[model samples]
Target chain A: MTENEINHIFQTWLKQHKALLFKIVRSYAFNEEDRDDLFQEIAIQVWRSVTSFKQQSAVTTWLYRVALNTAIKWTAKERKHQDRHESIDVSQHIIESHQPPDDRLAWLYEEIAQLNEVDRSLTLLLLDGFSYKEMSKILGISESNVGVKINRIKKHLTTKSEKS
Target chain B: MEFKEMKKIWDTQNDEALYVINEDALHRRIKAKKMGTKSRTSFSEVLLIASNLCAGGVVIISHLLKNSGNVAALTMGAMMMFVGVYILFLRWQRIKRDQQTDVSILGDLENAIENINYRIKLSQSMIWFCLIVIALTMFTVLNSDQSVFNIVLISAFFIVGFIMSRWEHKRFNLGKKKQLLDLKEKLINEFEM
Candidate 1:
């Protein structure tokens, strides 16, 4: 497709499924500004790769791949930025504007946030109803490995939630 | 609750689970992004290019002075320009690496680790060459009987640059490389777990 046509398609899909992007961003970023930065970063990435979106998988799958990868790299870079003394105190900037109204969902996301980065990605994908095959595709792991990891993550979460 | 029940709750979570996205702001961001890519330069690249310009200016000034021993000054300035260009090229490669998306988390982490490795290697490897250039430039300036003010300024630059480079190597390069490696190991270990 032409560049404009591809961008148009991407923007349309982005508008329709923005909540998917939101979930990924929220899982990764700690605050509202960070969330906005991550969302823009993901959007820019999607636009850059839109022309290469050969439709090999669903558009949502392609976006999930982009969003997760961007968030992973972005978080790494933010750590580097902090080390360089160039980062803001994101803790102080937490405005509480984006908190969920539901207590369980909030607690659930808190648990997800406590996960290691790789597990966090796995859990987010699992919660979004991705199949083992799909999660494996996005994570570059075997489907069996995806199943094992998800089981472990579920057990961990169950233990944590039970204690709380 | 069972995993299935939790999945149902997750699926049925309210829109409040997500932050409100402003469509107009998003559109504006997209437009700005399109404009920003034309002649795209990262922040690091801008700093590098600015230093290159300063080096280029030194080269022109030294060449125009036309002293008998100005050859060394000209040569050092030229070397600075070359190093600047080379570093900019490397920075461009790194910027491309940073832009890589649509990959798996393993791929992303691996790329991040590699990016840091490249930076550490570049800084570690360039120290001697930089010292040589600075020393030669100072030598030429002193040998040409330049003003004491200029001589002191060049000495200050040499001292600061050398110390900063050494400090960076000692303080950041080793620690940052180790940290990135540890992070990479943690990522791999998590996947295996």
Candidate 2:
């Protein structure tokens, strides 16, 4: 795609689906500074992802893959640099201005943040209504494997929710 | 509060106007990000390669300008050129491999592991390069009329440089590689069972 075409698609995707992208960022990063750094990285990836947009999968799926992969790498890189102190761009929240208004949603994210990186991704996909087949495809695992993990996640979350 | 209820809460974000996109600010951010994400190693490698080629060129030209070419100088200069070309080729291959897009997260993770392995290999090659160059120069110095103190000082300097390079390798590459490997194992275990 041409540069103008890519720019247009990026803006359009951001306008339509910033919430989706922001969910991955929030799920992956915890610290305020780290969140901003990750947001910038994800936004950049989304912009660049425009060129490689094959129509085989939905745009949202492609975006999720790109954002989650970036988040994983960023998380690994950030953990390695424990003493990092670079200033971040926080002029505007870009995607969303305020925190989730609902206490329950906030609580859910906390529980998600407790899980390992891969399961955190599975939680997002499962919560967002992706099918087992889609999850398997996105994760490069078997549908049976996805089924098993989903059951486990649901069971674990239900037990935790009851305790809470 | 259950998983189903959590899904309902999450789906609310679908209609939530919690996001506001400022086109100009986003344009600026994207532009900035485009420039910033190139790996620092890539930049340093380019500088090191240039320095090697230039250093090699200077040594070759200076030695050749004399009545007779110094065999040791010619060998050292050619080795530098060879090392530079070797690094360039490795970097080019790596960049090419990195450009291949894999839509699956597992595939991407695998690619990341491979990239880190390549970095570790590159770092090891550099250490080897330093050792070889030092040995070549040391052999030349020993053959010539060099005093014992001067030889000891040069050997000490080379030893210090070697020690520092190993320290950097441990500090930067090995730890990160282990973390990624652990993450991969965790991910695999989560679903494989």
Candidate 3:
């Protein structure tokens, strides 16, 4: 595709999926700066991949795949770096957000944050209403495995919710 | 709760609360991207200018020495050696600066790759400059009767320099490939874990 066409497509995708990108970054990043960095990285990656986007999948699916992949990688690097030092103070920005909290949703997010990178992705996909098959395609996992993992994750979340 | 109930809550939640991405913010990002591109292009231009100046200076010096006769042979040889050493020093400094700036994993990899490609080109030009200076100095110092031996020696030196240059090119490519692969593996492991 031409540069202009790619830019148009990216602009449209960005406008439509801005909230999805924000949520993914918020879920995966440790702080506001990290979230913004991940967001830009995802945007650049998406722009790079725009030419190769065959119509085989929906644009939303492609966006989720790219965003989740970038977030996962970034979070892994941050975790490795964090091991050597005190973690950056991400909680301050989280507290300063003006949105009123939903206790249950906040609890759910806290639980999700505890998951390993891959499990976190699966849970996010499940929460977003993607089917096991769709999750497998996005994640490059077997459909059966997606089902099994989702079941395990849901049970784990249920136990955590009950305790809370 | 059932999956459907969770979906209902998720769907109803206000996405606008998550982010307020408007045209103004996107416009700012676009401006940043353009500025970044401009900076990179200008940096490459600077490198191109330096490389041309180095090559041009060497060629002019070589021509002047060749036209000045046998007495000028020693002076030309000394000048060529000095120029070669100076070029090598400049090349070393450039490589050191590039290494320091390009080591971070946070920056865009494609930009890094492009910068490395430019450096490789510069290195190739430097190698050619060295070879040309050495050859011209040899030609100036040797008598007309020694033409056959000088040709043989110059040919051998040229071959050796060419081989070394090719090896350096390969090393450059291998380093870039390894970096890109490491990046890919890191990303895949993070998402596939």
Candidate 4:
């Protein structure tokens, strides 16, 4: 497709499914700056790959795959220097359960933040209601692994909720 | 948490402030294409300098040899030509490598660090090569009977060039490492949060 047509399709998709993108970014980025950076990166990657998008899978599936992979690589690289700084500030940003505003969502994110990288991604996809097969494709893990990881994450969340 | 509960929370969440993609800014970016243009200019400048230096060296050496019938000037010209060819070939290879991959913005940032590291390595090698060649030429020209003053001058030049090149190499590596670390940290924070 022409660049304009590709861009038009992307804009429409973005308008429709922006929340999913934002949700992934919000789960992965530390702050607004990082989120914006990832968003731009994701947009650029989507644009680059649009030419090769053969419609073998749903567009949403392709988007999630790109988003998750980009976010994972980005986070892995960022962890090298900011570990000390991140640990100190993480608690402050932890979502407080009783708050009525964004804090509640922050709480959920805080909980997500506590998960290991792989589990965190699996949980995010699961929360988005992707089936195990789709999650496997996006994550490059086996379907059984997705099932196993999701079950464990669910149990862990339940335990955390009970204590809360 | 259940999907229903999560969806409810998601629904209630406030809309994030919309990011205004300034058309003018994007237009400027398209026009400027700073990195692409800068890289192109740098490659071109290096090529021009190398070509001119090599050609000038050869012409001067030939003229000097023709005037004085000295083989030493001819040898210096040949050496300069070799270095120039090497530099040209290196630059061409680098440009080719850069063209092989297409990356997004973040990938570009990531690749920028790698490119910096690559440049550092190249600079370090070039510096060492230049130093070695300069030293060899001075030693061959001066021989054991060479004046102390000439030897000292040559030594000084080599030492200064060596020092500057080493400093640049270290600085480039340090900057690249810091950038990679920052990118790593940002990614981790996002994932953890």
Candidate 5:
């Protein structure tokens, strides 16, 4: 595809599906700097995916695959860099600027921030209402495994909500 | 709150925009990122290939200019040119392989790990490459009919170069290579109970 064509499709997808990206960012990265970093990384990955997307899956699935993969790798890499960290790059200014958040949503994100990387991905999928089959395919786990994970995560979130 | 209520709150974010994006900035950054990623990933290979090719070119040009009979320089020059071609071929193959889009997150994670492993290996090989270059230089210098003082100076120069390369290689592996391994470990062990 030509550059303009890729840009058009990317903009369309971004306009249509940015809420999903933001949720993943919030769940994966807690601080503003981390959020911006994750956002930029995901955006770049998504843009790169635009060319390779053959539409075998929904655009949302493709975006999630690319974005989640980037976020997971990035989160791990950031842990290594966190100790000898420099200030945020000027790329920090690219995508995300947060507004005041809803208290309940903020609480939910706080809870998500406490989960492990794999569980965090499962939570995003489950809360986004992806089916067990879809989650299994996306995560490369068996459907039964997806079911078991979702049940455990739901229970944990429930217990935490009640205690709070 | 029930799971149903929690689901409802999550669903509320479906149409709600939690974060504002700057589209103009995003466009600019994405273009720059595409360009940056290309250069950043291939910069080392470019440097290696270009330097080797330059070494080969200089050797050939010197022989032509001086009409000298230097068998060692000619052989080393051919070897450097061969190494440059070999690196180019390997890079082309990798680029071909990386173009395919994997179908799942697990596949993506595996690809990322593989790419990092390649980088780690490349960094390790680079230190070795430096040593080989220094050894070759020393061989050439030793074969030359230079004054004893000139031979000493040349040997000292190569020795210092080798030491500096060793330090740089260690520093690179410690920072970037260690983090890459950590990320790979995290990805592979992500599902562990």
Candidate 6:
């Protein structure tokens, strides 16, 4: 396909599925500016890879794969220099900017941020209503492992929510 | 907070659906992206280019400022240029590999693995090669008045470079290469399935 055609199709798909992109961003990033940066990064990756996307799988499947991979790599790079820049108070600006109107969704993200990296990703896929098989495919894990990990995360979150 | 209740809550949320793409911002982003890829040479690649330029400069300077018949200076400059050219050739191959548009997951995985391997090899070799050229060039340029201080400084540079390169080699293997290897193996298993 030509570049314009590819751009048109991607814009259409992104219009419908932007929530998926935002959901991944919100889950991976702590604050609003970070979310914006992650959103931009994911958008660029998708745009760059759009031509390479064959319809062998669902569009959502391909998207989650890219989103998860980018998030993992981006967060890894961020963590590498976290120590050097940890003294500055970044969270103050974040706090001023990120007052989510919805408390439940905020709490949900808080819970997600508490999970380990792999579990955090699995939870995002689970919350997006992916099947165990699809989660396995996206994550390169066994189907049974996805089931086991998701169940553990669910139970842990449920217990925490109940206690609180 | 059961899974079903969580799913219901997730499905009910419309607050997040409020975000819409602004065409102007997207156009700007796309333009910025085009610019980024056009100049996507990493810091190391920039260093390689700079080193090549410096080597070429040394050859010109040797002929103009120093004794035109100084064979050692000429030979060292020539050898440095060869090293620079070889390193640039390796870097170009890496850049080409990075730009390949392979859509399949397996293809992407293999490309990532190869890129990591290329990085490991490049880091391990470039440091020693550059160090040798730098030491030789320094000695040739300052050979007229070789003070004890100059010799000590040159020896110190080599020692520091050796230690840092050794540290980098270990760190790359333990961290980046190991992670990529695990991911590559998992990807192969995934594709096999």
Strongest candidate by TM-score: 5
**Alpha-carbon interface RMSD of model 4?**
10.5
Worst 10 residues of 2 chain B by lDDT: B17-26
- lDDT minimum window of 10 residues, candidate 6 chain B: B184-193
Any idea how many clashes model 5 has?
0
Ordered from best to worst DockQ, the candidate numbers read: 5, 2, 1, 6, 3, 4
Q: Model 5, B1-193: lDDT tens per residue?
A: 8988888988888876767888776666566666656643477778778988898889868976888877777777887888788778878876886777367887766665566566667767766766776677778887778889998898788788778767766665456657666655664465554
Worst 10 residues of 4 chain A by lDDT: A87-96
- Evaluating just chain A, the predictions reach TM-scores of 0.84, 0.88, 0.84, 0.82, 0.89, 0.84
Inter-residue clash pairs, candidate 2: none
Q: Indicate whether candidate 2 or candidate 4 has the larger lDDT.
A: 2
Q: Estimate, for each residue in B85-148, the C-alpha lDDT of model 4 and write its tens digit.
A: 7667767776676665333223444555666666766676677667656765675658557788
Compared with the true structure, model 2 gives a TM-score of 0.80
> Which residues of candidate 5, in runs, are more than 4 Å off?
A78-100, B27-36, B64-66, B142-168, B173-177, B187-190
lDDT of 4 by residue, A89-159 (tens): 22222111232437667777888888765567777777777899877666554677668777778888767
In model 4, the Cα lDDT at residue A74 comes to 68
- Please state the error at residue B13 of candidate 5 in Å: 1.3
lDDT, model 2, position B147: 100
TM-score of each: 0.69, 0.80, 0.55, 0.53, 0.83, 0.62
lDDT of 2 by residue, A10-50 (tens): 87888778888878887998765566667777888788778
iRMS per model in Å: 4.9, 2.7, 7.9, 10.5, 2.6, 6.6
Name the lDDT value of residue B83 in candidate 1. 72
What's the number of clashes in each of the models? 0, 0, 0, 12, 0, 0
Tens digit of per-residue lDDT, candidate 1, span B1-193: 5667667767764344355556667666667656655432244356666776597667757577755446677677777788778878888787776666446656655765676677567766667777787778777676776899989888898889889978977776677667667766766676675
DockQ of 3: 0.14
Please compute DockQ, using alpha carbons, for every candidate against the native two-chain complex: 0.37, 0.58, 0.14, 0.11, 0.59, 0.20
